[model samples]
Target: MLKKVRTVLDDVLDIERILGKISQDKANPRDIIGLNESLKCIPKLKELLHLEDIKKLNSAADSFADTAPVVELISEKLNEEVPAQLQQGHVFREGINKELDELRKLASGGKQWIAEMQESEREKTGISKLKVGFNKVFGYYLEISKIHQDKVPETYIRKQTLVNAERYITAELKEYEEKILSAEEDIMAIESELFAECCQKILDRADLIQINAKLLNRLDVLTTFAHLAIQKKYCKPALVSDAVLDIKDGRHPVVENLLPASDRFVGNDLKMNVDKSQIHLITGPNMAGKSTYLRQVGLIVLMAQVGCYVPAKKATIGMVDRLFTRVGASDNLAGGESTFLVEMIEAANILNNATAQSLILLDEIGRGTATFDGLSLAWAITEYLHNHKAVAARTLFATHYHELTELEHTLERLQNHHAAVKEFGDQIVFLKKIMPGPGDKSYGIHVARMAGLPGSIISRAKDILNHHLEESMDQSGTSISPEASKQLSMFEQQEAKFKKDLDEVDVDSMTPIQALQKLDELKKKHGL
Candidate 1:
């Protein structure tokens, strides 16, 4: 993903735009922040298609080493330098800090002399010992021992403590303790100041990183723009290919490098002669590389939009106002709409909004419906796209509807084309080649045989198709007008007749068995 973005960026900037600048070797907080901002807006860049994951991957990469470099450096410096001062002060402050440790020993009776004095004071006051604290002005003062003390010894008296009269300790001890504490405070203050300074340093470098990131993010887009300018530089508009994508060789960036030397792609040029007056209809059997051709065109347009080198040699791109795709269809099961409904909705949206500068690829656009309905809808959609919606946006509409070839002469921009195929006696072969003309037939029976269908079933299906096809050919010869409207009318008439019959039936008086009998009669009458 990173490599893809890098390629796109490289394509956009080109050699001249970059002026020999090298890619950044390291990532810092500034880079991370800029990436974050780019990611926030990438989802809204309609010009690029299906690049959400690419943007998200870069966003995650940006965060991988996004620590503030300055802060880390400062912290490292402070930790190394301040330890020496802390060690020196630890000795001077030891006596004051260890006072509790000494008191614990005295309580244990190891200091027999101090224990005797403590016992005497406890006997007079009914207490053993007390915890205490003090500061600079007041040395050390008793806490629990405060209320019990009567006359303290001079040695026990606090000569230094905080300015507030809260605790007490000896002046000699307080003086050294205060100096150690003050020094530690100064070190901490310096550490904090340095960290803040580091933050500022990172911010200072932000502009440069942000600029670099922007350049990288927009690299592909800019490259495409530049490439187009070069391609169309001084040529007359009509001199270019006729609304057709004519590349002598083309390769898929994501797949080209994976092929072995012997199997390496000799890029294939695509010639889609779609113009203000031409819509090429692509018809072929499944898995014959029809989808790959469609994707190649779509990817090319997207690359051009983003300013990158399209996967073609000597490419000439036409302007596309918007690109709409109704390629893959699925269901909105959560919304209770079936797969067919979802497919229709997307197809409707594309037909409603597409403009002449738009590029559209519709793969099996109406396949989710009944055979005749699907073929009719596909034909109408092709006609609409060719004659109306996008007279200029080159389209590659692939479908299984071979009958739609009749529109080739009727519609100005409508042309019939198909993926090439080979037939061996009764066997069929998918050549995966784009050629000029329509497929004479779909090898459904041949495909079934290839899929290991029983020979007996294949023979029976062939017989059934041959019988029906013979009758159809006799009825209308090679040209069969669409049967979709007739089927719809038939359904409407049936529904009306059923409703009329249903109005005469008295359901309220019928028993369970009677109702069942009545339903059976209705089914028989309608051939349900």
Candidate 2:
């Protein structure tokens, strides 16, 4: 059982690099129809093992990877598959069903038997109804009414000796009393044993039910794989196709459908032809389709490896031991780590452990840091993935820093890719298409403007940029001598004084009259 669980964990978890589609929620398949919903069968997978006719179904289970499609095709032809699966007390479901039935019958019989026994006691004692119940130092009992006292026989009276304040039973009544008391004991004993057995049976049946549930879950997984194959229009690949990941006509499944036809995706075709080679650097603009392309690759690999047909028109996949994704945002409030710190920890985990057969998808690897630090780290990580690590696992590294694109020239078996974009005057539109080569420009300011920034802010940003550009040029042409250092210090002192004077004005509290007085005072102080 543990081994089977381990197998499932490998396939179900770590979804970063498999393919471009989210796995359907396995536990609920009611909303899903056809083979896509087949995954729902996993909870009942264990049932296949316990049936008396499971011997006949062995062929179906053993050949599940291949000829199981025949079962689906046959079911489709006969139209009996669904009803058969839904029935309770299926040969496999009967063990649990029978146990539950037996328990219910035992409880019902126990109640009925007790009721009849009580009626017999009432008839024998001439006690038509239960009037009062009492427990004395001797035994439990039902008391008779004064009107029914005459119904007692002479033998009961003759044997009686006045032993109580009211009336007492003779030896004759004692014998009858023993009979009633014995009947109750007998009924109680039978009920105790019967109920204990029922409880035990129920517990056993519950265990069997749970086991059957797990088996059904496994069955659902198999069916899901078959359904995926049909949808992708591909045959299930042999286990030997273990080393191949071929995706033909692959589009980002989620994106392609949601986007308009005019803005629809251009598919990505990547065949990792080299063994021990897994890293491709992707450089593009802010709104370019790099992230989408990476996600597509990851989703595709995930689907294929899990034995499901991929979203691509055609694909033959390999087993990825682990798929690690360091994409998107994560908040780390409890850990007291910032967004960038969380990103770094995840990246570190991937870099430290990823192997040749592992799939790693990294998006904007170092974008959480300062410009130079982030770019440098991104560049180094790309180099490490390309040159140092086991390349057997595939990697898709996406970044906006174009300088890292230089790696394509430096590393063998390394390739450059980017998402395409179109420029419209000052407005650059993202095409959201993956293509070969790196992007040439960083449209950070352009994107910012498009997101709604005032014209005045844009102009101010441009002026600051120009001033910094000029300062850089001068710094590169000159040396920092002692005289220059002294001048810099004097400039800093004067700037400090100017800032102190500016801070002296309390703009928030100043009224209109105070503002006019301050303007005149400023004009006199500066001789304006």
| After superposition, candidate 1 runs with Cα above 4 Å error | 1-205, 216-244, 255-267, 272-277, 389-392, 454-456, 477-528
Residue-wise lDDT of candidate 2 within 355-424, one digit each (tens)?
7767788887777779799888887777777666454357888887887888777777667777777888
Stretch of 10 with least lDDT, candidate 2: 13-22
RMSD per model, one decimal: 17.4, 14.3
Name the regions of candidate 2 deviating beyond 4 angstroms: 1-58, 61-199, 206-211, 225-245, 254-265, 274-277, 389-393, 459-528
lDDT of 1 by residue, 42-158 (tens): 332322434555674345344322324533443333322222222222211113224433433333442353345445545654555543444355443443345444534445554
Error of 2 at 418 (Å): 0.7
How much lDDT does each candidate structure score?
0.57, 0.57
Candidate 2 lands at a TM-score of 0.51
